[model samples]
Target: MGIELELHSERPTWTESEVWHTSRATLLRGSYEHGEALEQLLTRLGRDSPGGLGSVDRVGDTLFDEREAEAALREIPGLLRQCVHESQTVAVHDLATLLASCAATPGSHLWFMGD
Candidate 1:
């Protein structure tokens, strides 16, 4: 049980036979350790209920559509500088990259699956 961030061409309904199938691009697969290390940053980003990085449930799921992704993309750089976890630096960078891709694509969405 961990956190997985995926980039999908469109909003996923999760009714697909294979959740991790070819419809999405796995951006980040973070273990409990990784999630713990980045908790501060995630919390600061905002809550998933408000279309931010922090998922509503620590073990549930959240989705960020193109607009939300763009909003996140704007804040990531400043938030990253405030991050103190060296181990999570790369993870955050990857997130920023994926967010950028999601923002650039018209109907793309970013999914945060946590468990």
Candidate 2:
């Protein structure tokens, strides 16, 4: 579960009531303290409760979307190229060369270079 925190930056300090309301809102919206929410969710699932099926998969899908993964994959080569171009010293060059060599080896390191 995730939360959308609306920080009241303009306020000098949050009142006790405001803090209580915010915490209540967060809990209502499925944000958990530590793994309590997940544990509760699993317990509910074992009992075949409707709450177990609510909002979990949607949140997970949004977090692990294909487009986001593709974008991260595309950025790696550009990052490596930038590192090589910005290497001004011998040590930096050596590090970049080592990285490039690792990147070239078949299945030696995880390279998600997508087409």
Candidate 3:
């Protein structure tokens, strides 16, 4: 099982299965084990943190609207700095880059899909 981060121009119209199979959205994937580490880090950061970083559901789905993406962008740098593992660093950076793109594109959303 793994997690996928997808960028959609608007709220996706496809069903979850269809989104996985057919959507041509920008995507980044990571192992579920890696996601667990990321989630632990987020937990340490506190769930109520302003950027909603702690709200990511690593075993389910989480969606970040453009405004939330903008807030997350502000927190990514700090998150990256706290990463001790190289894979964690890469994941955080990749997520940040994707979120930044989503934030800049009006109406875009970032989806964190886990399975």
* Top of the candidates by lDDT: 3
Per-residue lDDT for 1-115 in model 3, tens only?
Answer: 3556778787655686786554555343323335555664665677777798778776788888899999988888789889888877877877787788888888887887766
Q: After superposition, how far is residue 89 of candidate 2 from its true place, in Å?
A: 0.9
Per-residue alpha-carbon lDDT of candidate 2 for residues 1-115, written as tens digits (9 for 90 to 100): 3211111112122256784554343221221222322223222232232322222232322121222222323333333343332322332233233334433432222111111
Q: List residue ranges in candidate 1 displaced over 4 A.
A: 16-18, 21-36, 44-51
Error of 3 at 32 (Å): 10
Screening candidate 2 with a backbone cut-off below 3 angstroms (N, C-alpha, C), the clashing residue pairs are: none
Kindly provide the TM-score of model 3 when superposed on the true structure, using C-alpha atoms. 0.77
Summarize candidate 1's per-residue lDDT along 32-70 as a digit string, tens digits.
345554555676655543436654345777788889898
Cα RMSD to the true fold for all candidates: 4.1, 20.4, 3.2
Better of 1 and 2 by TM-score: 1
Scored against the true structure, residue 13 in model 3 reaches a CA lDDT of 57
